[model samples]
Target: MVCVFAIALLLLGPNPAKAESREQAVDRLTDYLFYRVNSQLNNRKLQTDDREYIRQWQRLREAIDPRVKSVQEVCLRVSPQEKGWEFTTINGETYEQTYDRLADTIFYSRHPQRTGQPIPTNDKIGISEWSAIRREMFLSNCGL
Candidate 1:
């Protein structure tokens, strides 16, 4: 009975190198993105010059690396509209963006270049553009 229990424990134990499921992996990535973005915004609001937010963002970026392939394949498989606050890849880089109707502002770590006109505020933009900005921000800031 002890031997059987030990075998069962080994079977149930964690595997450090195991790949996470798509949902689990994306969820992890999303949490990291959310935390980093929120912290940066909050710090900005407080008028603090803290750089701790950058460290948090880096941690999230590292977490997403292992799950990139899975995330890319899943993104291709799903409809764009159906993808919510999850990690998706563009140009072989992983990024986190949400598409909920209630989201008022989109956050990006990196600012994009514009040709002539200034970039419109989040409330005035389309979803596609917003998502593209999010990806660009992730790539620029998260070191992806």
Candidate 2:
């Protein structure tokens, strides 16, 4: 009985080095993108620059790295701004952000170019972009 259980475990357990499927890769990338956008939204709303918030944001940003290994990776560039930072992804996507300390607001934009102009919108932009990307990913490969 012990031998049979051990055999079952060997057959059923996950392998650490196995490659991810295309569907899984797409789903993971979609989820990571959403999480990254959501983290920015949270960071924009806080009244104070709490340490925990920064830590959480960093975690979410880091999570994106592992997913990139499953797909074709491109260039990622980051530039520090006066108030925030600009991030550009491999897929021709760029995020430019700025914070208005006096108004306590965050403004940002998403575009395909590295030096793309920001739309100067609020946090709701993140939600809208997330939904659009989710829908596109779902239709592309995740739905299959």
Candidate 3:
């Protein structure tokens, strides 16, 4: 019986030294948070909001080397802003601008008007632009 239990444990458990890396764990957590929040907010949610959220988790991922053993530690180290999470835009803008833009798109259908300029449909946010895209966010909002 003891031998059988030992075998089961060996097969089921993560190897101690080769356990999940912090980045993988953080990615898993980020995915779960994104899923739960988007499920609740439904169509009212913008997928990009997870950007800042993942950044926070990545900070935690950097801070801690070991796999998380308790929710308390994670909670202590990371918590969402009581208000909208701070985020910026191509120009200088706060999370409020994103929120207002979202509102205009959803509630008012007046999203086309941005600072008296029509929303540029030609702008494509691609992988090559992520560095520049996040540069403003990293400089202005992300404390990390």
lDDT of each: 0.44, 0.37, 0.38
Compute each candidate's TM-score over C-alphas. Answer: 0.28, 0.25, 0.23
Model 1 spans with C-alpha error above 4 angstroms: 1-18, 40-136, 139-144
User: lDDT: which is higher, 1 or 2?
Assistant: 1
> Who wins the TM-score comparison?
1
lDDT of 1 by residue, 1-144 (tens): 999999999999986565556656555554544554464364342223534445434444554544444323454455544423334444454233222210123333232233233456664554455454344344222122
lDDT of 3 by residue, 1-144 (tens): 999999999999887564454455545544443333334445243356666544433443332223323333323344553222222332454545543433222212212234345434564542223223223221123334
Candidate 3: how large is its RMSD?
14.5
Question: Which residue pairs of candidate 1 clash?
Answer: none
lDDT of 1 at 85: 34
Q: Which of 1 and 3 is the better model by lDDT?
A: 1
For residues 21-70, write the lDDT of model 2, one tens digit per residue.
Answer: 64455445534444444454642543366555444334433533433432
* Candidates 1 and 3 compared by TM-score, better number: 1
lDDT of 2: 0.37
